[model samples]
Target: MGAPSTELQELIELLNSENPRIIQPACEYFSGLSGTVDGLNFIIAQEDIFKQLMKFCSFENSDIALLALKTITNCAQNENGTYFYMACDKQHFCTKSLFKSFENGDERIIKSSILLIENITRIEAGARHVHAFIEDSKLLESLLKIFVSNKPQYQDLSLIFGNICQVPGVRKLFLKNEGEIFNKMLPFLSHQNASCRLGAANCVKNCCFETDYHQWMLKDDSILAAILLPLAGAEELTDEENDSLPIDVQYLPSDKERESVSDIIVALVQALHKLCSTQMGRDALRKYNVYVILRELDKATIERDGNENMTFEIHNVIQILIGDDAAECDDLNKLEVPPEIEKKLTEMENA
Candidate 1:
């Protein structure tokens, strides 16, 4: 950290210029600069740089604000810088400035704002700060509005919910939404886009952390069935059903397509592991014969030498559902193996 370079100083001054022309380029320059560690440290070293950048977030011109938000998002890449952004003005970056930018009807600004907030909440300190503002403002509702509108920002909104919902209170608010967030995300388990399914699975995984929420999830057999769909590879997302598959995925030959399916399996297995923590939750899984699905998936994954982490999770969930006794059976996949035979098999193996 030598003394600030003349170029850095000039850019900082140019960012503060009154002319929109100068400001826009300044935003772009800073955006590029924020990409590197040295450049990031330069911006972080500048006094009140974030405070100055906050002014650009609401310049009445969407492009400038978008660039400004981009720079802010880039700064968010560093944990220390994120704390600095969150602390710029007692959380004004989130509360007044960024929230205003979020509502300005600019998709770029909205997306950038979502990413900035997501970065902020990456740590608990920043998460707690944003959570307080979320309780008071229409932040969560605004995110839901964007989501239900089926806008481009919906994926980012899904991720924002995943981060915010890690807070227990916000998660309950999510469950109470009119559409019932659980129901909204459940069908995505069968979505054609693999990332869509992964995002939905991660959010659902966080929701299951709350013990009280378990009943809402477990009470509906249909919910469990729909969730299992992705894991079973039961339904493929056809072009007729969903036209939104990324062009790269849609154009690739069929043989290359199952790559997406493997990612979804990892998310589903991770979610089920979280969902099956309690005895009642385990009972619900058993009622739906989810263990059968898990065993089949486990066998397939082991045979394929698939994702080791996901395969391990599938094994763990099956054990939870069928109990420690299942571990003793000759073939754990046989859900109906008798206790006597299981004991004899274990005795003979141990012998």
Candidate 2:
């Protein structure tokens, strides 16, 4: 009855079938689509579709139901977050209906709550209202399960945890009372999934302002080599290996690293470039061999950023290090890229 797509309708119809083949692909397709909540809310408003999804969330067939659950959540939480929050707060509407998704023996419903709550938090000043849920402490247990859940739960949980960790009081609770929380999520930094690692990294970065997160990260075995290695040295990069960093460390034309995620990489380059241009981060970079990573990253930007703002920023970094004329050894003493490396960089500029 709502504005409809054949794909959405097709997935909805296929949900009625008991065939595993139909349900599996249907779940995949459902997960892949980001439909308007109007369409999903309209469909759920119907008695039949609501009942079917509820059944799937039950112990009967959670695998299929989890797919529709996230889809519905995505719609409700999309740009119309305020609308959904207002509606959910109403007793008989989406809020009541959503809470019903959580039930005994229903892992899918429980898991889907991560996305739904995340959307709720996006409302203007809406996080304050959602924090009321955390006040109950019941959500904390569910949150931990979702945070640590494997497979499909990983990204969703990381997102929800990321948001939860942002609330000022909530973060303190985890750090002060639940000391093990951040450490539990450390392994996620090296997750095979880039988005997962990126999300987890941002989460860890937040913890840096509290306690000993940066020092802790420096020592953690899982994160140290994978992340710190490139930042610590100018080693060769394979196509796959280079794809890993937020920056393209390979620095070559036609290299193939692609993502629509992790804006933090750009943020890191910009931040480090600024930090390095200063007497402090520059001194730290030189003393710690961090300049090699910056130099290679700068070379990559020569073509990728092409004298763009990012290039100008790196220029500041280079200027500070070599004193605009390779006349300083004070800062370079800490950085060990060798004179030959500097000569090669100068040659590239002239060429």
User: For each candidate, what TM-score against the reference?
Assistant: 0.75, 0.49
Residue 42 Cα positional deviation in candidate 2, in Å, after optimal superposition = 8.9
Worst 10 residues of 1 by lDDT: 241-250
Clashes of each: 0, 3
lDDT of 2 by residue, 58-141 (tens): 324566656666655665565553354444453334444454554434555666765675676554345555555455555665
Candidate 2 segments whose C-alpha is farther than 4 A from its true place: 1-72, 90-111, 122-128, 136-142, 149-151, 177-179, 209-261, 264-291, 301-351
How big is the positional error of residue 50 in model 1, measured in Å on the Cα after superposition? 2.3
Off by over 4 Å in 1: 1-9, 136-139, 177-179, 192-195, 234-264, 302-306, 325-351
State the lDDT of candidate 1 residue by residue for 54-172, as single tens digits.
67876777788877777777887789887777677584644466766656667777777777877777676776778887785366666666665665655665656666667777777
